[model samples]
Target: MEHPLPECPIARFLTVLDGPWATLIVRELLTGPKRFTELRAALPGISPKTLSSRLRRFVLIGLVTRTAYPEVPPRVEYRLTPAGTRLQVVFDAMAAWAEQDLPRTGSARGADR
Candidate 1:
């Protein structure tokens, strides 16, 4: 069975950023443009395959841009588009909500066991 896309904004947001790595990838790119190797280094546990997949999706969805330069080594850089940068406000709101409503846990995820 096929399901129609959700009309709710939150659902649409989740439809785009569904996986655990999606938001994390955006967060990393939020700092500045980075190469494939640099992104892998910045995100310690992320597999190269996963990073590539996310970046590709981001580019397709107009959230990111991938620029390849003609150089001896073939340099490529990934940067957030203006729409992606707007997500910072969403992140900020999430942080504020979590600080006020969510319980304190040492771990970043803060998932209750």
Candidate 2:
């Protein structure tokens, strides 16, 4: 069911969350900071190009912070910002709902296919 635009806080949040990939990114980051390669490994289905783009967008939106270490190989890491961490409760609630309410699909709530 669709609700009126800009009228609800959740709707606005969803707008920022946007696409399927964004939520997945958020979910993964909930674990802790991770390098590009780590994220790529965790989300094997995501192409490098798309992951780069989403990380860029997340950085721009203040939901994520990218730190580049001045090392020989230039290691970079991504972590959620304070505002981003605020969504942990939301993620937890979703997990609870999925475990209690979703159909038993013989896998996780949002497991990669």
TM-score of 1: 0.82
User: On residues 7-78, what C-alpha lDDT tens digit does candidate 1 reach at each position?
Assistant: 999898997789768888887888999999998988899999999988998898899999999998999999
Scored by TM-score, the top model is 2
RMSD of each: 4.5, 6.4
lDDT of each: 0.86, 0.87
Superposed by TM-score, candidate 2 places the C-alpha of residue 105 at a distance from the truth, in angstroms, of 3.3
lDDT of 2 by residue, 22-98 (tens): 88888999999999899889887999999999999889879999999999989999999999999999989988878
Candidate 1 lDDT for residue 86: 91
* Candidate 2 ranges beyond 4 A from true positions: 1-7, 106-113
